[model samples]
Target chain A: MGTRNKLIYLLAALGGLLVIRNLYVILLQFPDEAAQGAIYRIMFFHVPCWFICFTAFLAAGVASILYLWKRRMVFDNVAVSAVEIGVVFTATGLVTGSIWARVIWGIWWTWDPRLTWAFITLLVYLGYLMLRRAIDDPTERAKNSAVLCIFAFVSVVITYKAIDWWRTQHPGAVLSFRTGGGNIEPAWEMMLLWNFLALGLIAAAVLLIRLNQEQVRREVDGLRRRVHEL
Target chain B: MRFLRQAGTIAVKDLKAELRTKEAINASLSFALVILLLFSFAFDPTAEQTREISGGLLWLVFAFAGALILNRSFSREQANDCLDILVASPVSGAALFIGKAVANAILILAVEVVCLPVFGVFYNITWTKRPWWLLLVLVLATWGLTVIGTMFSALTVNLRLRELMLPVLVYPMMIPSLMAAMQLTTLLIAGEPVTGEDIVWLRLLIGFDIIFTALGIGLVETVLVN
Candidate 1:
């Protein structure tokens, strides 16, 4: 009944409807490609996961900077929530990409520049989480992890630039759909955007839930400290 | 001027302590040598393949042995609560961080200097060609390692699992610099000329060193203050 809960339900319902509609088009309505066939359809889910991952990580980095600048617990909470969600989406992106690779590329994995950077990015953020678990004090945890978060974002930028710096076998983005460039069919491109919108809504709902959980965690910690004093 | 002096003094203080005991240097040098010998037994040192991988092997030794040296940069302050004293001192956190990073770089560079030749001897590769270029790569790459290593050392110094956490946090960040360093070192070790594309790796190395150095100095105050 709370406003936050109601918002979550609204977003989830909207996202679910869009997802069902997109799936109907993808599985039934849309025609197969000339070259890669139905297998290439995984790009609908695969690319959006990366989009969400990058978006969440960018949010985490900005929140980290805000936390360090303002000394606000709210910013730290946002940073941690964004990073946790970013990590899950990054894992999803990797899994989906790997399955696609197994079918298309004839191997489960390759050390192509993008793939290599993706794996390293996964490790780096996982390290960020581990660093968080290692510290006890809430303030220290926030400060230290914020610092690491900034460094991790730099690595992410380096990863993105790395694809340009090195030759990559991974297919380049078809996002030039806006300018009407690239080889993608117009229909596939439209479906991609629809799926992204749905996924983004779902991810936002999850983020709100995560923020609420973090609020509860802080409250519990406050109560435990008070109990210790009593 | 005072800030530079403060930084210099801290650097000298650590170098003097390291000189007195030589514990880290001794352990690291021996560890580096042992790894080199083990690498020789594992790979036929004289093989054509060995030359291709020698750069990677040499840096791996430095990285592993360097971890031993870097871990002490801040944890040494924990003894007698010296971290508190240093933080309370007139020197700023930036100075403390730079000084410690500088000292760590010097220490690791010394180990690398010794290990490089030993690595040459063990692997039967002539690393003496273009000594100046090799030194430049070593300096840039070593500075890159210590900057992140020392910063993370400070970040994790107070943690319960400091040793375990430092490497996990630091190594992923080091990959870019390490990749650049490895490629340049591999090419240099083989006495090849630096072509246009190889120049990118060197630029990346310098960029990494500069970026992390600035970040370390800017943020150390937050990390050091309780």
Candidate 2:
């Protein structure tokens, strides 16, 4: 394997080990009563997935701004790759959230504000992908989809604030390290930080791989077009 | 001042064309009325539930109608290759955006005025109780919708599935605005006292309008150029 491929494989293996460690802590080591018992184990996967999804979306927004500013196709590819990874993480978050809800709330789904807004976020990005597919011209597609990504970012801000504006059953935020009084114990905090770092690295690795694939596909298409012209 | 003059000319040109054709107004108003009628029948106009849901119903109709109007607002510009002409002109993209937004707001407001009385008749609700407040809410909410709608309409004008794409792009962003408007209107219709919370919602709406208007102004050049 080339040096780059070897490096990626090492990172991928490290990511896998971290995930395995997370499962071990949740299932065998950590006390069941830590988050109200064994039921809370879902947080090990769910919370990190959600955090990674939002981070990916924020990255997509930044990439979109860069694409619009520089008119670079690479930035557009980065934006699309980030969003596609975001969708995967979002789906993972949704399914894990459903399982958590079933165990805790005794139901699979409720119109609870957080759940509803999560669904809305999913739909909005799905619509973004559909909009990209509907347009044929590459430059036009990039411009339109960049605008959409920016708009979706703005909409997320509004949606996040909506629950506070209207009274809803969704619980207020749990962890706020920024405010300096995170209620989590030191051990749990360490585990959480490890999980977050590991998952974030995994998400970045996936985005890079997808971006490379997109570049290769674009190059192949260009070659085909050139051959046709000849 | 120069930009305003150019924008005014563009606005006037769109108004004159719309006046001669009357296509956008007719299609949007008819579609809105049909939605209202369907809601009336589906919800049982005489039920207490209908009274409670009237605010949501009205906003839903307006949202659909607004999308329809927005979709068509730019299609003609694209069809006649007038968008190319507009872009080539010395007018700033921001000015063009304002021109289109103002024209669309006027069209949507006209539809609301016509539909409001029809709604009252069909649903048997009295309209005279809080006319000023209701109108105020309508104007503010519609203003916010039209501004964002016009910007997206311009952005999506070049897309293949313009009709389906506009609403998918717009409605999710408009949810907070629609929710706030619906809640405020519900209070007004029920003769409940408007509280400080209502003002907070109004401020949210205004904030959305300002932020989106600024973003639209900044990015419209990008949209127009490519």
Candidate 3:
């Protein structure tokens, strides 16, 4: 197998191990909370999913800027790949948040600022993918979607601020790293970090796989164009 | 100064072309009126509750109908290769973008001017107290909408599904501006003075306008380059 394939397998294996170990620590080792018990555990996944989502989106936005600045196909590939992963992580974040809400807030959804902005962010990036589909030329697709991707990050920033500004049903920060840790158990904070590391590894592996797929797809498209010219 | 002149000249050129046909204005005005009528039927427009939602209904009409006008901004230049000629001429892409955005803003505002009175009549609301504040909100919000709409118009002008693509992309970005505009309009229409707390929405409107206007001008050259 190639070096790329070896790297993928290695990352996936390491990620799998960390994920199972994190799950063990999360479910078995961790005790039930004083309030909200098991449902609150969803935060382990929920917070990290957003962490992954924002990280991926930040990567995509930076790559898009580089694409525009340098006129590079690799940057375009990175932007598209990162976006696809970002969208999946965003969906995961929303779902995990929703499940937590259903238990705690007594509804499947609410139009609170954080939830509303999350939904809007999802729609905007989905629009980015649709816009990509509507264009045929590769260079035009890269440039237009690059511009759109950069603008789309604005929604992400707004979503982050939504919780901060409104402080609605979504609880304000409790994690021990932000806003002076907000009086949460340090053990829980450690567990959240472990979960984040496990998840980040998995997301990084998926990103690599997607980038490789995008590279292969581009090669095939280039070859097809050559054949057409012949 | 030269840039502003170029932009103004392009804006004038577009306005002249649009004024000649009046197709977009006619369509958007009628569409706005129809939405107002339909909304009145959907909700008892005379109800006390209507005052709470009147701003939302009004801006919804502006946004949707104004989209009709925005869609035509660049596509009209496609006839007889006018877009090519415009790009090939001395006009810069940024000027072409601002020019088209300004013209679209003016056209959309005109439609709003016609719709506001009809909306007032239909919804049984009066704007006697703060018409100037309402107008400021209208101008700021309309500029925000047209800047994003016009930029996306250029982006999607040549696509196979231009009409469908433009709105999907534009509306999400329009949310901040629309929310600010809608809330300010509602407050003003209710005869309430603009308070310190409400000033934030106005700030949001201005910030959104500045951010998007700058982005539109900065990126239009990339979007419009063949």
Q: Show the lowest summed lDDT stretch of 10 residues, model 2 chain B.
A: B189-198
Residue B45 CA error for candidate 1 (Å)?
2.2
DockQ, all models: 0.88, 0.72, 0.85
lDDT of every predicted structure (CA atoms): 0.90, 0.81, 0.89
In candidate 1, what are the lDDT values of residues B168-190, reduced to their tens digit? 98889888888889999999999
Ranking by DockQ: 1, 3, 2
Q: Under CAPRI classification, how is model 3 graded? A: high
Candidate 3 displacement at residue A131 in angstroms:
0.7
**Residue-level lDDT tens digits of model 2 in B105-207:** 8888889899888988998876557888888888888878887788888878887788888888788777767877887777777766667767777787677
**C-alpha lDDT (0 to 100) for residue B187 of candidate 3:** 97
Comparing 2 and 3 by TM-score, which wins? 3
Q: List clash counts for every candidate, in order.
A: 0, 1, 0
Model 3 stretches with alpha carbons more than 4 Å out: none
Model 3, residue B6: C-alpha shift (Å):
0.9
Clash pairs, model 2 backbone: A32-A37
Q: Comparing 2 and 3 by DockQ, which wins?
A: 3
Candidate 2, which segments miss by more than 4 Å at Cα?
A159-167
Error of 3 at B56 (Å): 0.8
Q: State the displacement of the C-alpha of residue B135, model 2, in Å, after optimal TM-score superposition.
A: 2.0
Q: What would the per-residue lDDT of candidate 3 be over residues A1-230, giving only the tens digit for each residue?
A: 98988888888888889989988988898888878988878898999899888899999999999999999999999999889888999999999999999998899899887889889999999999999999999999999999999889989998887767665777777776566864778888887788888888888889889989989999999999999999
